[model samples]
Structures are given as C-alpha cells and as structure tokens.
Target: MQTNMFKRLKRTTRTALGFACLLIGIVFILLPGPAVIFIPLGLALLSLEYDWAKVWLKKSQKYFRQAAVKADQALHWFGKKLRN
Candidate 1:
C-alpha cells in the first residue's frame, strides 16, 4: 500500500510538471523570450506521458540543434570576414 501511494505521488508530480512546462511554452510563444527552448522542454515533459510527444520532442531537438549549428557557422564566418 505504501508503495502504491508513492507511485501515485510520483505520477502526479510528473503530470504537474508536464502541464507547467506546456503552459510556460505557450507563454514564451506570445512573449519575447526563449520559446524555442521552452517548447522543446515542454514536449520532452509531455513525452514522459505520451508517445507522440516523444516523437515531437525528438524532432524538435534535432531542429534546434541544427539551428544552433547554423548560427554558430554564421558567427564564425562573420568573425573571419571581420578579421580580414
């Protein structure tokens, strides 16, 4: 019985965290903040509860990583040009 209670508590905590992440992601979308980061984080939290969310999180992570790489490359190119 105690074990069951602990399991229930853990589940509830995850649910709450997932919902909070989702809400934060939405807010970030409307505001001028880290929407890209928050949206992926929210999807990751939701992935704990749903398979579809897991897929979305994976894709989002990939896209974000690609964007980061591109941005880094652009910055490097800009720095080289500036030095020249």
Candidate 2:
C-alpha cells in the first residue's frame, strides 16, 4: 500500500508538472517569451509516461534536426558561391 501510494503521488506530480509546462508554453506563444522551447520540453517530460507524447517528441526532434541540417547546408552552399 505504501508503494502504491508513492507511485500514485509520483504519477500525479509528473502529470501536474507536464500540464503546467504545456499551459505556460501556450500562453507564452502569444507573449514575447520562449514558447517553442517550453512546449517541447513539456512534451518530453510527459513522454516519460505517455506513448503519444513520445511520438510527438520524436517528431519534433526530427523536424528540428532536419531544419538545422538544411540551414547548415544552405550556409555552406552560400559560402561556396561567395568564394567562387
């Protein structure tokens, strides 16, 4: 019973924190803060206990990585063109 109580507490805490982060992130979306960073972090935290969040986190990571790679490639190409 003690272990069960502890488990429930842990789960509840995690869920509360995750939702808090996500909600703050949403509010920040319209403000002048870092919503993009917070939202992903929230999802990442939630992903610890949720499969749907895991999938979303994976997709977000992949998209960001691809964008970074594309930006790098574009910069490299631009540099090459400038050199020529």
lDDT of 2 by residue, 1-84 (tens): 999999989988887888788888889989989877888888888998899989988897898789789999999999999999
The C-alpha stretches of model 1 lying farther than 4 A from their native spots are none
Q: Cα-based RMSD of the predictions, in order? A: 2.0, 2.5
Number of clashing pairs per prediction, in order: 0, 0
lDDT at 57, model 1: 85
Positional deviation of residue 35's Cα in model 1 after best superposition, in angstroms = 2.4
**lDDT, model 2, position 56:** 86
How does candidate 1 score on lDDT? 0.84
Model 1 residue pairs with clashes:
none
Native-vs-model 2 lDDT?
Answer: 0.87
Alpha carbon lDDT of each predicted model: 0.84, 0.87
Question: Cα miss at 46, model 1 (Å)?
Answer: 1.8
Residue-level lDDT tens digits of model 1 in 1-84: 999999888878877787788778889879888888678777877787779889988898898899999999999999999999
